[model samples]
Target: MVFSLKGKTAIVTGGGSGIGKAISTTFARQGAHVCILDFSTDNGNNTVSEIEKEGGSANFYQCDVSNQEQMETIFDEIAKNKTINILINNAGIAHVGNIENTNSEDLDRLFNVNIKGVYNGMKAAISHFKKHKSGVIVNMASIAASVGISDRFAYSMTKGAVLTMTYSVAKDYVNEGIRCNCISPARVHTPFVDGFIQNNYPDNQAEMFEKLSKTQPIGRMGKPEEIANLALYLCSDEASFITGSNFPIDGGFVTLNN
Candidate 1:
């Protein structure tokens, strides 16, 4: 089977950096017109420029995925000019705190960005998919969705919600030719991890970095491009038979960590 996305259109939230950026670029490379949606206009534009430099089609959109008004407006505008065949809900925030340290505000912020953001994106895009009678939704979940992790109460909670959200959407739209799935990645080697190390362990950055890498059973973290490759397969025509599932891209973190 051929995995081709030529002539398709995709919207990737958080497409400005890390995993989202990799996914957006990969889709564009596979011949999909990608919309790089992010709260950071500069990063979004940079991603678009990179895609264009590689002779791939892409556009930048500054959007706060948690805001319903902003999301609705952007989706409306995109729908006017292009058919959105794929929606990748990837914008997320990581909160490094346990239940005792996580306050109401902390919990609310995670909920808004990680949970409601996915919800609003799907809700807005569902109408267009229903109209077209076919589409795919891929949510960015995490290993936290299926297993316990320390100091990740808020993050884990949000990802668990994401997993269920994918299932619900798939069930509701199965007959409509709309497929919904999710990817649960473990520690990925991204700038986010680098920044976290710099900010939290300025004195022993390298030591802490090694520690984080060993957390994955494979002795290292996964790469953004690896996750992006999995996403490309899932969103391609070859994956029409796959839906309502959460594919774990972790290096044995969820199943072999014991």
Candidate 2:
């Protein structure tokens, strides 16, 4: 099947860098007019400029997905220009702490961004999707959603909500022609990983990076573009039959991890 998105309009949250940037770029390359919603104005503008440089259509909107007021205003403005055909809930924050170390504030922050962010995006775009009678919603979940990981109590909790939210949206909106699904990726090689390494193990960054990469059975971390590839397919018309499913793009980490 041809995975063409020509003439389509997609809204990608956190489209400034990492997996979100990759997904936004992929959508633009596929001929979709993309709206990059990011909290980082500079990064968002840079991403839009990059897409335009490649002869693609795109716009940047500075938005904090966790804030209801900000999301509403941004959606209202976007609706004025065009109907949103795809919504990628990719804005998320990662927390490193076990249950005992994780305080209520930590859990709340994670939930607000990871879980509520996805919820807000879906909620904001549902009306547009309903009006058009068709739409695709893809959430960026994590392997932590389905499996336990060390020092990720709050992050895991939020991702689990993302997985279930995808399922719930798919079930409720099936009749409305809105497809909701999620992609669960493991240990992707993004700037976040680099930052974590630099901040935590300043002296042994490379050694720790290697150790983290080796955590995957594939012996390396997954690339951002690799996750984007899966996302591209899931959002394309080729995946019309698929919904309410969690696609694991984890270098066999979920199934083969010992």
Candidate 3:
């Protein structure tokens, strides 16, 4: 029963696919009533179906994290019926380019989904957490936030914001019994990575995949489940003493890259 999330309610943005999906299912399995939010209705519902198939409780909401009004409304609605105990700000988009190639439009897009999206989710949930005087917030950041990553100008910019924001929230809400933490994952093996490789290196998919996998000192990309496991621990009661912390699950990418 250690690390159990039984009777807790969790809201996971972008929970339809990739790391989000893994986190959503894992939370549900740990006895949380998972609320999955995603722009894609199909993917969201599919995740719900999978959770239900495993006898886990889950609900799907079609959501766009950048839309502030929509997020507020959804959070209000969920709070009316369930006490949201965990909020995972995992919705984000990626762009591959240096500053020279990352135009204004790309920067704005990243700001909207990667930076503003996390802001909107937290804004909607913080009040409830404060009122309840207890809640857990886990944000999904990237190693790019802490270390220099080539061709990730805009991405790194937004993730850096996520990291600092985590600290701010945790510090501001610590006395309120709310904890906020972030996970900076290196390259995680997810559908997004597969699609990126297939689209950009279609002719040399295997080679490109190998190259990307080797970027981590572990000799392979981290698994979505691995990230989810860490997330689960952070959100569970076992991490009660933890807050305002940045856990880098990067497989030495931040330290070993020289």
Candidate 4:
């Protein structure tokens, strides 16, 4: 029964693909009634079908996390019939550019989805959490938040905000029965990674992919499922005593990269 999410309702933003999809499916498998919020209708519906095929309960909501009104409405709507137990802020966009190359538009784009999106999710759920007096939040951060990841200026800045936000929320709600924490993955192998390599290095996709994977000291990039497992635990009862923490699931990249 440990880490079981039975009878609980978990909401995962960006639940359509990549690490988000892995987390959504994992939560559904863990017996949670999963609410997947994703902007991509195709991906969202597909994911819901996949979970349904597995005999798990799930629903898909097309959402733009940066849209406050949309996020608030969806959260409230879901809260009406189900007790909101967990919120996973896993929706984010990535950018690769240092300060010199990153324009204001680029910084703004990442900020909108990575930083504001997390804020919106948390804001929309905090009230219900306080009313119920119990809730868990797991945000998807990045090792770039703590380490000097070259050419990830905007992405790193946003993730660092996520880290601090986790601490602040956990501290503020510690006595309110709400727990907040984040997972900072080094580099997870997801569809996004594949696409990134294929699009940018079409001639040497495999080589580029391997190069990126080996960047992790563990000799490979982390799996989306691995990150999902960590997320499930953080949102489970087994982690009741855990909060205000940042878990670096970076394949030792943060520690061994020296």
Candidate 5:
């Protein structure tokens, strides 16, 4: 019962796949009624079904986090029938390119999803939290925010914003019982990774995948479950004393890399 979320209602954006799906599934298993918001209908529905199959409470909502109006509507609907306890801003798009290589369109795309998406989720949750005087927010950041990674200019920019946003929210709501924090994971073995490799390295998928994995000093990519477990702890009552902290779950990538 250390990390128990019994009776709590948790909302996870991008809950269809990768770390988001893992967090949703894990939250449901920990006795939470999980609401999964994702743009992919199939991925969202499949995740909910799988959670239910495991005898966990879960529901899927088709959502584009960047759409403020849509997000507000969904959040309002949830608040009407259930008390929102936790919000996870895990819905984001990744861009791979330095400043010169990244075009305006690419920058805009990252800003819309990676930046505005988190803003919308936080905006929607803050009101409910203020009314209830208690809430937890766990944002998914990246090591790129802290470390200077090559060819990740745009991605790093947004992640850096997320880190500071966590700090600002945590400080602003400290007395209101709202805790805001972010998790920075190195590379995780998700379907997105597979797709990235397949699409970009069709001729040398395995080689490229291995190269990416080795980027982490740990010699392998982190698992989705690993990130999900950390998320579970952050949102649980056990972490009530923790706020305004940036957790780097990078498997030595941030520090050990020479």
Candidate 6:
């Protein structure tokens, strides 16, 4: 029970699928009342149902993290009845292109979801945490933020901003019992990755998947549950001493990869 989140109310952005879904379910299993904020009501509701089936408490709120008004409205509603103790900024979109190939539109789209989305979530959660004098924020960054990766100009930029924002928020709110940190994972294996390969490499999805997996020095992509476990630990009371840190859960991609 060292990492117990009993009686805690946790909010996870993009909790419908991928890493977000994993974190949501994991947190719920740890006894937290989880609120999933996702754009896809179907997926979000599905996750909620699954949690309920497992005897865990959860609710789904349809939302787009990029829209400040929508986020503010939903966060306010959550705060009405529940004191939110944790926020996971895991909603983000992927873009594949270097600076020249990435047009202004692409950059703006990435900025809105990846960068501004984190900002919106943090901004909304900060007010609640400020009032309570305690909160934990776990942000999902990417190895792209620290290492130079080809064809990921915009993504790298946004994740880099996430890292800094984690630092700034943690430093600013540390005295108030608020802790902020980020996790950087390299190529997590999710449905999105499978779909990406199937759509882009219809004739050779398996081959492309293998190629992508080998890109990591560990010879395989990270798992969504693995990332979730890390997030759970970071958000728990056991991590009280942890803040303003960026944990790279990459499969040796940051160090061993040449």
Provide the overall lDDT of each model, using Cα atoms, as 2-decimal numbers.
0.95, 0.93, 0.96, 0.95, 0.95, 0.96
Clash pairs of candidate 2?
A: none
lDDT (10s digit) by residue, model 5, range 1-258: 889999999999999999999999999999999999999999999999999999999888999999999999999999999999999999999989999999999999999999999999999999999999999999999998999988999999999999999999999999998999999999999999999999999999999999999998989999999999999999998888999999999889989999
Give TM per candidate.
0.99, 0.98, 0.99, 0.99, 0.99, 0.99
What is candidate 4's lDDT per residue for 1-258, written digit by digit as tens?
Answer: 778999999999999999999999999999999999999999999999999999999999999999999999999999889999999999999999899999999998999999999999999999999998999999999898998888899999999999999999999999999999999999888888888898899999889988998998899999999999999999998899999999999889989986
* Local lDDT at 107 for model 2: 89
For model 2, residues 59-143, the per-residue Cα lDDT tens digits are 9998989998899788889889788899999999999989999999998889899998999999999988999889999999999
lDDT: which is higher, 2 or 3? 3
lDDT of 4 at 84: 98
Q: Any runs in candidate 4 off by more than 4 Å, and if so which?
A: none
CA shift of 223, model 3, Å: 0.3
Tens-digit per-residue lDDT, 151-189, candidate 3: 999999999999999999999989999999999999999
- Relative to the unseen true structure, what is the C-alpha lDDT of residue 255 in candidate 1, on a scale of 0 to 100? 86
Model 5: residue 229 alpha-carbon error in angstroms: 0.0
- Candidate 3 ranges with C-alpha deviation above 4 Å: none
Q: Once model 6 is optimally superposed onto the true structure by TM-score, how far is the C-alpha of residue 67 displaced, in angstroms?
A: 0.9
- Predict model 5's lDDT versus the native: 0.95
Writing each residue's lDDT as its tens digit, candidate 6 over 1-70 gives 8789999999999999999999999999999999999999999999999999999999999998999999
Deviation (Å) of 145 in candidate 4: 0.4
Going through the candidates in the order shown, the clash numbers are 0, 0, 0, 0, 0, 0
